[model samples]
Structure formats: structure tokens, C-alpha cells
Target: MGSTTIGCDQRIAWLLTSARLLNPDPELARRDGFIKALADQGIKIDNSRISRWESGLHPVSGQVAATYEQALGLTEGSLVAVAAGLRRTFGNGPAPREGALRGADLTDGDMDRLLELIDEGKGTGAHWLRLVGQLGTYDRVYLRQQEWAALSARLVQELAVSVGVGFVRRYEAAAGLIRHPNAQRHLTRAIGGFVMNPDTQVVAPVLSLLTEIADEAAGDLVLRMLTSEDKNLRSAASSVAAVKVSRGHFGAHALPQLESHVVGSLRRGESLDGRLDSFDLAVQLPDESWERAMGGLRNRRAFDLVIGSRRGGELVPTQQTAAVVQRLSAAVQRDTPTHSPHENDAMLRRLLRESLLHAHKPRRHHAALLLAATPYAPAVAKHCQDLATHSNDLMAARALTVLMRVGHRMGRSRVLLQSLAETRPTIRARALVNLGLNPEPIKPAEADALLGHLDEHSRPVERHATMFALGMNGGTTLKKLAKSDTEWMARSATWWLDQGPALHDSDAALDQIGAQT
Candidate 1:
């Protein structure tokens, strides 16, 4: 590539002209006065050197350029960037079409012209791309300066257009340029101006970008957006939060708000139009559904029984509510073994057994989970084995997972090995993952056999499961999978390798699976 560097004489001439225009007093342009001014700012440049630079006899070095900027109150790096030809196109006159305006030199009219160009660029793909590039250039220079108020006003004007494609792209590009905290805060406030507006199609991207870059600082604003009465705004916020949280940023703090919004709506018997199910399930708070159910039954008889049996009170069977409470009670007891007396274990065992027989799939799944946590028994094992073979894919997967956990605890590898031979990839993947979780190591031959079952064409979800199993099992196969050209397989293997022995929670595991798909 040819060098873009300007000669020293050309750079010095531009610097002298810029310095003359920027200095408050015209006398500061003269050698003696300029030297005095540099001295005032603690710079010790000689009068002869200043005269030589203005006469184009020599170029100003970086040190002198910085000194001149400080002495004249110009934006830092503006002169040095000019001297080094870093921004060769920016001149003392109005900014060129493709160049940026120096922060100190930017004026209200200049901002207006930029906005006009952005407006004109809308709907034209190539023009919009070029404008976005120009906006990025301007942001690099002025985003950190006090010109935000003027820039923000221009942004607001652009956003007022019914279709805000140009302004949104500018917002994204500007956000990408922000490196300082103050710049981020300024941009966030600018974006926040549109949060209350009903133009979701335009506002969502801005809010999404803010949440991503601002971290917890944007949490309160996002929560408010999520709770807005406007369905569009709420949906937009939820979608933004889903992406942010799924990437492992902002999720921990924002989850309570999401759970309350979605799960709370569910508990109030309000239909979410299937929005609740569509949310990234990996981030769903564990036990959220059960907690909501328990909250609903707080005033009912079933609530009393689950909290603490209504001592001597007549236990009225409310049918459906009572059955749910029974399942929840078993789950709770299994979760808190020490709190529940030994006798309650027996009661929980019976409740889990009856729950397994219930026609409700959720009830059956919950029962299997609770059973997996309970003490081993021939009947419990039999129930798990039976459910593992059930025709329902979801229920069967849950059963097989519980069976693996129980078998691992009991040191019985037979069920796990049998599960590995299952034809369904989902089942086989789950079995492989659960088997890898067992403390006892699988023999090399068995592990190699399992690894050989996976191929480059395996479904993303299946590959995700296989990678985790291989990662946990420890083999050369994971390293090979990590090098696979398939994006999902490579990502999953890399994530598994990074996580090492630390277990992946349901959300993270689901996130890895979801991202590739």
C-alpha cells in the first residue's frame, strides 16, 4: 500500500492555519506571542521553531503538536492526528464529505448538514452504508466531546422520521465508537430519549445496543421498558434482554425483572399470546413455574398443607389444586431433606409415585425430577426405567435424565450404557452428557465408541451434547471436534473446553445449543 503520510511542510502549514483560527487572540499567531502563550501553558517551545513551522521550513513533531493543542485549548490528538496524516482529509475549512469534524470546530450548522445527508441516505442500501461509515468517522472524533447536546438534538430529529433506518444505523455506529464511560453515558441518554416513544421498530435496536454496552447501568431503564403498557415496547425489551442475557451479559441482574413480568403474568392467569414460551428458555429462572403456582395457592387450602399441614384442620380436597400442591410438596421435600423429618421421605416417595401416574405431562416430569433426588428404591428405579421408555419425547427425556442421575448415584452403569444405545439423538445425547457427569470414569474403549458415533453432519443440538460429553470425559476427540469447520460444533467444543470441569447450568447449556441453531 502506498504511504498516505503528508510531507512535514504540508502538515506544519495546516497546523499553523488551524492554530491561528483557534487561538482566542490574533496576536497568539505571531512567533513572540505564540511562544509566550506556550510558556504560559508550561511548554518551552522557542519562537524561532514556531516561525520555522509556519514558514513550512520543518514539520511539527508529535510533542510540539500536543503542546500546541494544550496551549490553544484544541481537542487532544486533533493536531497530532493532522501532523501524522492520520486524518489527512480534515482541513481548517468545512469538513469534507467523507472526513470528520474536529470536536472543537464542529458547529450547529455542520451537525445539521450531517443530519441532512443521513436523511437523504435512507432506503438506499449503498448510500446508507456509506453514511454509516461517515457517521462512524464523525463519532471517532466528537463522541467524547461536549458536542453531545448538539449531536443528540440532531439524532432526535433524524429519529422523528417515520422510518428511522438512517438514524438507527448512525446510533449503532456511534455506540460502537464509544470507549469512555462518559461517552457511553451521553449516548445512553440520547438513546433513552426514544424509549418512551411508540416507534418500537426504531427504538428496539437502540435499546438493545444500550443494554449490551452499558451493562447494569441500563438495567433500570430496560425494566421500565419491559413493564410499559405498550405491548410493542414490552416485547422489544424482552427480546433485547433475551439476547443480552443469553450472551452471559446483564442476565444475572435482569432475570428477576423478566421472570416477574412473564411468570407473574402467567400466575395471574393472563394469556401472553405464547410470548412466555417463546422467551429464551435457557435463562428462565429454575422452579419459576412451581414458584408461581405456589404463590397463586397462598390463600387456598392446598397452600396451608404445603406450608405446614393444617394441624387438626379438616383437609378439604380441592381436586386439581390439591394435586398440584401434592406434587410441589413432594418436590419441596426432596429439595430440603434435612428440614423434612424421616417420615416425610416416605410420604414424598408415595407422592412422587402417584405424581408419575398423573395424566399431566408437567406433573409426570416434575415427579421424575423429584424421584431422581429421592433415596434409591426398586420401585423408584422401575418407575424411572418405565418412564424412560415412554412414547412422549419430553417426558421420556426427563425420565432418562433422572434415571442417569440415579444410576450414577447408585453406581449402576447398565441403565446409562443402555441409554447410550437409544436410537433417538436427543436421548443418546442426554445419556452421554449425564454419563460424563458421573464421578466414575468410563473405559477408553467405551468412550471411543461413543465418540465414533458422532459425525460432522450431526444436528447442532446433538453435536452440542456430544461435545459436552467428550469435554467432560477427556479425550483427543474434543480437540478434533473443536477444529471442525462446522460453526456450532466448533463453538460448542470451544465452550466446553473453556468451561473445563465446571458444570454448565441449564441456561448456559441451552444457550450454546440455541446459538448454533
Candidate 2:
């Protein structure tokens, strides 16, 4: 092969690397499998060729390169990325002009031109499939600093409302940008703009991206955005609400992901020192569904092992709660104790009792649930109240969460709401979340009282909940909430309005209506 063939080997190397990144163990090719398979094909390539491909040795043959490309599902010109990588690595590089997205300032005119250029016969599926392919291409070139601003801005304007699936494509493109160190900062800012745009109808796609990339800070950013009072923004953030509901479901199917995600975060090394502030990304289960996750039949043995065994609290042993929860819950229910059941019972009770005594300390779900299920209410309520006031925001959120769950059962929501009304803004924010999740119906008048909070508070969560409650309750309040600033609530309100008149004549429905005047 001539020196012109250099890019081939690098391309092969990149393909191999990218595949391994996605699936470290490509089961189809174990030790010597590639060589043996090639031998069977009468190709008789040296092991070095395979090793070179893995380690990025010499340029591969056109035939072999095509085979690798097929196996990897690489798009056209993907090998060019190897050249891009080489330029990035060795400093010998292609001219910036060769691969840069030309005509960077794409206006409506440019977009229209492209639209007209495409054959209209491209069906929806083909369009999306092509878009996905194009996205991978975009990532290879568009992530760099000078290149991204123009490309991203054009993309945001062009694809923002084209289709929901396109938004997903956009996000995948963004993820590609994120992986490239040279382009990440610019792409990050661009993504923020794309997501925050009020005119963008592709909120779900953006949200899916946000969640995929969520870390402590990113999760907090998402939580803040999801509660925004802006109707358009909130509506766009519905993906987040759906995610929240899913994470919190604790359903049989979701348990494993939750354990691996949520419980694992808590027991991670950082958390052992009590330094972890948020488990947003770490946990897949919602805060509300933890009890079901832990207490469910499938989780019993794992639950027993964690709470019963000395090794339970340790980080590594219970890394993925899903499998453990399922296995343990199954085992415990089968009456096959991993340890002595009586001893486990005693230990749990003792832990519950101890939690009550030091109720002021930040408590985990197990400790809180044990207290809630305890025969004692006053003690539980007192600690719950303390948690509601705790300086740590997440702790306060969790505290209010436990209180709301057990409070209504004890007929204490009125008291809880009364107390919440006087709490700090941070605590009040969580309180509103609890109130919105309240199972009991409030009267229209009472619901109005909560709805009235929309005008008084600036917090997004509070406003959203107040709107949700108002929508749930009917009459003039519902109409007003439909026009509310928060898009999420407005959508909900609109939905309720469409459904409410049909059910209006039912006495059961009227009784179920928010407290009447």
C-alpha cells in the first residue's frame, strides 16, 4: 500500500475502538476468533493484522476495511474521522477548510434550499434514518470550538420543531460533541440554548438528552428547569416528569435499574462519608417508589441482607440494587432467610427505634419508612418536622416526602400544610411537591387557597404544583390555570377542562371536586 493508504489503518483502529467503547466484549469475537474466522474464509490474514486493527497498526485492505465498516455500521466517510483523530493527536492535520461545515450561517433561505434539494419521496422512516446518519457525521466535524457555534445554531433553528425524533438525533449529535474534548464547552452552551428556547417544540428530546447526561449539577439544573413557571418551558420538560414518575415507580420491571442507579448512589464511597448531596443520576427509582422497591416481595431478601447483614451498608456489596432487590425480595418472601429472620426483624426494629431517638439526623429511606410504619406517630411526626426544617435541601425534600406519605394516613395533612405555609422557601418548595402529590381531593375553595400560592411565590415547583392542583379542582380556577404562565400546568389544565364537562353531571364527580364554596 502507498503512503496514501495511511488513513485506512487509522480508520480501522478508530472503528475497532468505537465498537469496544459501546460493547467492550463483542461476544462474537473472542481470543483467536477473528483469525480463525478469517482463515475459514480463506483470507489467511496474519494475527498481526487483527492486532494492528485493535492496536491501530497498518492501513487495512479495501476489502477488509469494507468488512469492518459493515460490521460496525459506520456511516459514509467515517474513516475520515480517523484522519481527524490523527490530526488531533499528531498535530499533522488536514486544512481546516476541507472538512468544516460550509456556508455556516444557514438562514431560513438556506434551510429552504436544502429542503427543496431533497427528493420528497423520502418517507418519514427514511428521513429519520438519514437524519441519524447525518448526525453521526455532524458530530465528527461540528464539535470543535470555531465550528460548533455556527453548526449548532443552524441545527437548532432547522430541526427544533421538524419532528420529535429529530430532536433525539440532535441530542445524539450533542452527545458526540460532549465526548470530544475540543468541542464540549461550545456544544454544552449550544445545547443549553437549544433546550431553553421557548419556541422549541422538541422538549422531550432535549429532556431525554439532559437525563442521559445528568450528574449532580446537571440533575439540579433539570429539576430547576422542570419546575419553571414558564408554560412553554414546563411543557417541554414533560419528559422530566415522565422520568420522575418512572424512576419512582418501583415496579417489578424497574427494580433492577433503580437499585443499580439509586441505592448504589447512596452506598457509593462518596456517600459513606455523608458528602453526596444528590442521587439524581445515580438512582433510576423515584423518591416515592423506594418503599415499594425495598418492601416489595421481590426485594425482601436483599432488603433483609442490607438491613440485616453487617456487610449491607458497605458500598461495593450492594452496588446494583435491582438484581439484589429482586433476588432478596424473592428469597425473603419464600421464607428462606439469608440470615435468621427473627434476628433480622429484631435488628430492623432496633434501627427504627434508634432513628426515632436521633430523628434530627439525616435519615435514609429505610430508617424513615420504619419510623412511619411504627406504632408511634408523635415521634415520627416530630422527626418528620425536623427533617422538613433540615438545612440540607435534599434532606428537607426527603423529610417532607416521608411526612406527606405517612401524614395523610394519620390524618395530619391539614396540620402539615399549616406548618408548611410558615416554612422557609426551600422547604416550602418541597412541601408544595408533596401537596400536589396528595391523594385526597381538596375543595375548589381549598384548592383555590393552594392555587392562590401561584401569585405569591416565585419558585417554579410551587407554581407548577399550585397550577396542577387548580386544574385538578374545577370551575373558574381551572380556566385561570389553563392560561397560567407555567406550560406544564396549562397543558394539564387544558386536559382537565376537556374532560371535566363530561363528568360534571355525576354526583360522585361533583363530590370529588375540590372543596366547593
> How well does each candidate superpose onto the true structure, as a TM-score?
0.32, 0.30
Candidate achieving the largest lDDT:
1
- Which has the greatest TM-score? 1
Off by over 4 Å in 1: 1-346, 349-382, 404-407, 410-412, 483-487, 502-517
lDDT by residue for model 1 (373-411), tens: 223323455555555665655445655555543444453
lDDT of 2 by residue, 65-149 (tens): 3344334433322233233222332233332331111212334453333333232311221222233233434435433455457
In angstroms, the error of model 1 at 447 is 3.1
Q: Rate the local accuracy (lDDT) of all candidates.
A: 0.46, 0.40
TM-score of candidate 1 to 2 decimals: 0.32
Superposed by TM-score, candidate 2 places the C-alpha of residue 342 at a distance from the truth, in angstroms, of 16
